[model samples]
Target: MDIATGAGLLAGLTVVVTIILMGGDLKAFYDTHALIVIGGGCLASTLIRFPFVAIVHGLPLGLKFAFTMRSTTSRDLVDELARLAEVARKQGPVGLEKVDTDDAFLAKGIRYVADGYDMDFIRDNLERDRDNFLMHLDEGQKIYRAIGDCAPAFGMIGTLIGMVQMFSNMSDPSKLGPFMAVALLATLYGALVANLFCLPIADKLHVKLADEETNRTLIIDGILMIRDSKSPTLVREMLLAYLPEKHRHEEGEPVPA
Candidate 1:
């Protein structure tokens, strides 16, 4: 699980709820008309911008990525590649078939090498797979961003409608409170929905997209190095370049225990 995503979401919701409860009755904040305005507008706007498939598939995919952690880290991939390099040197490409990896992209590359595929073919397929995966992440990011963008505009619309209604009722003191409630409530709903949910998830997905691209690229390089029959130490050093500077080890360092 992604602790940061989960923790951040939970903390935001907790603070919101606590503030609401401390202020007054939470039920007073609820208005069916306000909800319909914000919810309906966001949904309609999103549909206008994206296909239904994006809502059906993209939303769940985005949520899944937000809540889950990547199975393999770049450092782990370097270590795994180094080990596989030794196997390739001693037992040849066939030895790679016995290896296991947590990363699906790395596994696919390993399969290609073990099957005696050409290096160009391996690189092309890996790059295609990486691009396709990144494209989906991009779609998810855009969908949520659209929703976040639409919400506030719709809230303002609803508030304006409420104000118009409130003004029309100026002669009658009785109906002002209800109309004003709709106005205030719509804004509240929009702010909460955009800030607490859609926008944050969109930003998180953007971060995920970048990390995935980096990791997949790193895996591709490591896989090709293994295919070339590079020495284990050399592969280790080369793959270490893909990691952040702080994570890279120095030359002639003691071997990991």
Candidate 2:
């Protein structure tokens, strides 16, 4: 589990709840009409913007990725690739068939090499896979972003509706509070949902995408090197370039000619 995503969400919610409780009469903040206008309107707008299937399938999957701990790190990927390079160097590309890995991308690349595929074939297929995966991630991000964008607009719509109702019902002072509550609560809900949940989830998904891309790229390069029968040391050096300078120094020596 990703502690940062989980903890940040918990902290934000705790603060919000604390503030609401401090204000007394927390039930006063509950406005069902406001919720319907803002929540329903946001969902309707999102549905219009994206494919129904994408929203239905991608959103939950995106959230799961954001909250889940990624098992593979760049360093772990480099190490695994370096080991594969050694195996290929000693026993040739056919040796890779015995290698088992949980990483699908790595496994696919190894399979291609073990099957005697050329570099062009490997690069083309792997790049296409990378692009498709990234495209899906991008769609997921867009979904959350659309919700963030629509929530505020819907909230304002609710506020306007409430204000209009308040003016029309001015003859009765007792009904004014409900209308005003709808107006204010709608805006509050919109801000909270957009900032605390939608946008944050979108941002986290972006981070996850970046990390995945980096790891995939590293694997691609390593696979190419392995296919070429490059020395494991050289493969290590090449992959080290993907890391930060501090990490690179710790993980590898200078690349030799």
Candidate 3:
């Protein structure tokens, strides 16, 4: 799980709830008309922008990407690759068959090496696989962003509709509070849905996309280095370049706590 996403979302909801309870009960914020306008409008508009298939598949995929952490990091990958370098050095390509990796991409690279595929052949296939996976992540990011953009606009439209109804019914002062609350609630819901949910997830996915690209690229280079029988120390040195200067530990130095 991604702790930040879970924690951040929990904190945001807590704050919203606290504020709501400070003034009134949850029922005060409930408005069927406002719900229809914001929820229905946003959904309908998003459908116009994206295909049903893309929305159906991409929305859940985007959420999964947002809430889940990457299985491996560049530092971990470097360490694993360095270990594999040692194994390949002693037992040659066949040694990699005994290794197990949670990462599917890295596992495929190991399989290729163990099967004695040529360096060029390995690089070409891995790069193709990396590019294809990246395309889906990119699509998910765009879909979330599109929903975020649609939400606030629909919120304002709902507010406008409420205000028009509120004004027309100035003859009934008792209805003003309910009418006004419903109107403003649309804006609140829109803001919350967009800011608390859609936009943040979209940004997280964007960050994940870049991180994935970097890690996959690092793995490809690492695999190629191993295939060429590079020394474990030398493989570690080259792959360390993929990490930030802060994360780049000296050979004998312990990794930062």
Candidate 4:
């Protein structure tokens, strides 16, 4: 779980409860209707905004964004590249054909090497993939941001409707507080949905994009470095520049060599 999200939720709930218990009339709130409008509105709007297939495909990606931080580092990527280089240098590109190609970033390079593609084409194509992946991430983040912006606006709309209903029967002043609370609830729900859910997801997706870009750029550098027949030691050292200083010295350590 995201510590920031967890802490913010706990703190917000505590404040809300304390405020309500101190003198705020608990009965005047319109949380249920707020729930219906925000929940139903967000669902309907998101469905309309994205294709059903894309939305379904994106469900788990979004959930992953919510729960997981991208953790693969430059050192890990450099190590894989160095190993690939060792194999290619020993037996030529044909040797790589037998290697697993499950990782998308690594698979692209392996596929290029396996297919006997020229070094220039291989580098250009893999660079294109990196660009496209980053573009996809940016586009995805925008969708979540749109939803975040809409949630609050819909909340305000719901509040207006509630006010209209309350004022229609305004002959009794006793209904004023109830209607006011209901109106306020719309803003609260909108702010909560935007802040707690949509915005956080967008932010997380951004972080993923940044980390992924770093890794893919490392892949690009490694691929080109290997294609140029740069020494494995040199390739490893260059890649380590992308990592934190702590991982640098390990680049030269022998693995029983």
Candidate 5:
């Protein structure tokens, strides 16, 4: 689980709730109009920017990221590749066919190798596919950023509308404060959603992309090394080089084996 994502979101919500309760009138803050203004506006804007399917699919992923954890770690990926490398060395590339079919991303390269595809062909195809995958992710993040940008502006608009309505009733000066509160509240809610939700998800997606790239590259190198029947120690060393500098080690060193 991604503790950082979970902790950050929980802390943010805790602070918001604490502040709202301290305001002494929780019901006043829970305005239906405010909900319509902020939630409705954000959703409408997001829908306009992204496809219906994307929005639907992303909703659960977004909530999961916000409330829990959803990211792969470098060590987990490195370990998986290392294991695959060992398997390929023992039984040749054809051995990986079973594992490949299960994971779409890994399956592509593994299948290419099992089919006796040339090294250049496998590398070119995997690299092209990886680039396309990364580009698709980038586009998705851009959509989320666009939605984040729209949410706050509409929030400000909601505040202005509320304030105008409040000022129209000059006889009831008491409404002035509430109207101002609505205005400020909308802006707060908008900014919160943008900063705490949309942008953060985009950032998380970016991180995931980087980690996947590393994993894919490691697999590419490992596959090539196995195809050439390189020594096990040398193949392990080459794959290990793709990892972060801190993870690489001397030939005889203990590696949690």
Candidate 6:
């Protein structure tokens, strides 16, 4: 699991709960009408903006990515690719067939080399796949951002409705408190949902997308090097450039030919 995402969510909730408890009358915050207006309207507006399929599928997937730990990192990909390059150099492209890999992208690239695909064919296909995946991630991000933007507007609408009701019922002093609660609580719920959930998740998804793209690009480079029969040491050196300077120096020196 992603500790940062989990921790951030826990911390935010803790703070919100603490403030509510300290203020007393915690039950006052709950308004069924406010929830229906803000939450329901936000969902309706978001569905209008994005495909229903994307909203239904993308949200859970995006949240899973944000909350779950990634199976691999960029450094792991670099090291694995370097090893594959070494195997290819020693035993040729056919050797890669015996190499077991959990990563589908890496496996596909190796298969292409073993199948004698030209450089252009390999590069074009891989780039297209990467672009398509990135486009989907972009759509997911936009969906979350749209929810964040629409939520506050719905909250304001709820507030206006509450005000209208409150004014119309001004003759009855008993109704004023409930109407005011609806107006204020709707705004609170909207702000909380947007800032603590939607916006943050959208930002996290963007980070995940960038990280995935970087790893995929690294794998592509490694596969191309293996296809060209580059030495393992050279492959290691080339891929190492993708890391920070500190990490670059930490890698073992290239093996002597």
TM-score of each candidate structure, all chains considered together: 0.91, 0.90, 0.90, 0.73, 0.76, 0.89
RMSD of each: 3.0, 2.7, 2.6, 5.2, 4.3, 3.3
Q: CA lDDT, every prediction?
A: 0.88, 0.90, 0.91, 0.77, 0.71, 0.85
Give the alpha carbon lDDT tens digit for every residue of 133-208 in model 6: 7777777788888888888888888899989999999999999999998888888888988999999989999999
As for candidate 4, its clashing pairs are none
State each candidate's clash count: 0, 0, 0, 0, 0, 0
lDDT for model 4: 0.77
Prediction 3 global C-alpha lDDT: 0.91
lDDT for position 130 in model 3 = 95
Q: For residues 1-257, what per-residue lDDT tens digits would candidate 1 score against the true structure?
A: 99998898899989988998998978888899899999999988988899887677788888889889998877877888889999999999999999988777888999999999999999999999999888878888889888888888899988998999999999999999889999999988898888888899999999999989988998898889888888999989987877877678655665455
Task: Point out the worst 10-residue segment of candidate 1 by lDDT.
Answer: 248-257
Sort the predicted structures by lDDT, highest score first: 3, 2, 1, 6, 4, 5
lDDT of 4 at 49: 86
Candidate 3: regions farther than 4 A off: 171-178, 250-257
Q: Using lDDT, give the best candidate's number.
A: 3
Clashes of 4: 0
Where is the poorest 10-residue window by lDDT in model 3? 248-257
- Can you give the lDDT of residue 82 in candidate 5? 62
Error of 1 at 212 (Å): 0.7
